[model samples]
Target: MVSIIFVDESFRSGRVCWIKDIVVAVTAENMEAMRSIIQRYRHKRISLAEAGATRHRSIFNGLKALAEDQPDVVIIHDAVRPFVEEDILLRVVTAAKEHGAAGAIRPLVSTVISPSADGCLEHSLDRAKHRASEMPQAFLFDVIYKAYQQCSDYDFEFGTECLQLALKYSHTKAKLVEGPPDLWKVTYKRDLLAARSVIKEKISQEICVVMNTKDEESAGHLLKEVLKKELNCVNVTSTVLDHTGGNVQKFPTDQCYSFICVNVVSSEFQETQKFLSTLEESGLPLLYPVVVVLVHCCDLTLAPLASKMESLMWIRSLAEDMKKRNVLLSGLLLNYSKDEQKLQESFQQGASIIAALVKERSSALAGQLLLA
Candidate 1:
């Protein structure tokens, strides 16, 4: 129910048209960037505001824009730093509520030096004693509003820091929360690429279920029911591969980026293997990072060591090949049970694994074996 106001600004150069295109793609079919997200997700509590010419002016305008709404706290974050996490947001908001002001900080990665008029370094400051102030700074609504109102025009036009404004006007010492390195801002073309990649990982929600089980009807029905309830705004489809594997043609392989291969046992990986081939032939991985999950439902008590080893070898081989093309491959061995109680537990666990794979978006899990 928390509200977010995404501040927008004009880029100085036309070379960065891609940034505008990315924003347009993300906020299409809605009012503004923040409003689009709020409406798409049916979040009634959030709102948006047009940014001002300068950073200080934008924050001041944002606070004034939300004044009538009477938000308990207002968070001012830079749009360039897109890696801000929800936990860090919570920490800042909580601290702001308690201390009137709070901000994220990281250890200075480089030494700070004072330069003389001749542009030579005069002295160096101890890096250990200093910290870099980062975005996602929060303040009690009244505190920031009053600070902005009492500020001088020179400070408003030239100041780059918000913590200093709060300290100068309201005498509020901001609580500093240690933040991770991913909070780094996007300042160059390479940084923009990294930011876009992070955004893709967070926003990708479509998942495909490749059913290779003998009881395709039952397996597909159970997975659909669980996924529909567990994942939010997820587009899930089940593809049933016939004995000849030609039925795979019916799958909308290009529409979905994540795939889950469901099989009754390790040896039945042929169908899943076939689907992986289909993916490679389509060349989707080269355009976007693809995630492939192999879920093997088996009665481990009845499975022999030889079959398990064979499956592991196959998984490893496929994973190695796919990794080269930006396709992440992971496997889960689930103990199948017919009893209603055990079966329910397994279904939940399996659904969780699929959800985690799609959400994490990291290749570290590739070639890893998981027990569900």
Candidate 2:
């Protein structure tokens, strides 16, 4: 029997700003397929069109419905749990199938305190005895749903936990496992930087730049070739498009995401400024919140960054403009480094700036569809 995974969260449903009402639901025969779906998107020819099994309702009724339609097993997780690795998911599902219930947990990082009668003295629980519950909670579908069905309006209106609900009525004990620190929920502004850092680390080592640069009147083709040799894991592909006027012939539906550039090259700083200034006035492509960047530096000397910040200042300033549009943007100066290895590293790093930016916003939004 296939297991269903429920990744619940309120993401910026249509507009990429306020995350008020949204939930993504999906099901896979096993955990490996669930992970491959994420890794496969590195190429530009993947599809993330899975049908969601169940949808979360506003308030607490969402869980109530999951309990109504009992299945083999239901795994409720947080979409904000981007750091959730596949192995962690495998362990929980397997355990739930065997023991009827399982959940991921971790040691608390903060003290647990409650207020006293008159703001004087309260009690605090020993942190060692308490566990901070993370997500990917799994259970035999029937066992959990029945518990919800038996719940009163009080339970249905205010319940914030699945494990506690299972424990209260089904009398099931959840087998808890430690989770990685990155599994921390993204609830504040600081977390955006942390999320970007994680993506940067992942792209530094393994990346493939497959492109069709046959019709370029410029140096994008040459950049791709040299970039392949410099970065250890970076792969490059540049072939002629078959009557298609695009770098990537197919829209990646699964593993990889795409970031397309729509800017031309110029030498004079004023001309470059004029080119980018038009982006602010033009909203043709700015309709989407994710910002887009146009790189102008194809040839510049790489002298330890500090020696040449003026020529690159245009790119930095442009990145700021793109930020307002919600797209993180930047420019790269393709220049010779005195150290041959260092020059190559510079080129590879430039390519990664674009690749990694694409991966972060390609989350598949699950809706309407139900589980098997």
Which candidate leads the pack in lDDT?
1
TM-score to true structure, per model: 0.54, 0.51
Worst 10 residues of 1 by lDDT: 17-26
- Whole-model lDDT values for every prediction: 0.71, 0.50
Please provide, for model 1 over 269-298, each residue's C-alpha lDDT reduced to its tens digit, 9 standing for 90 to 100: 576667777787776775567888877777
lDDT of 2 by residue, 1-372 (tens): 323333543221222122122223434443356456445332221122233333322212434443334446666667676676666767777888887888889898998888788986488989999989987777877767767667776665566677887788899887887777766887787888887777655433332332334446434554556546554464334333222233233322122222333223333345434433443344323433332334333334434444344534555555555555444444444444456576566556655655544444422211111100
Residue 168, model 1: lDDT of 95
Q: How close is candidate 2 to the true structure, as a TM-score?
A: 0.51
Worst 10 residues of 2 by lDDT: 363-372
Error of 2 at 331 (Å): 8.5
Error of 2 at 22 (Å): 12
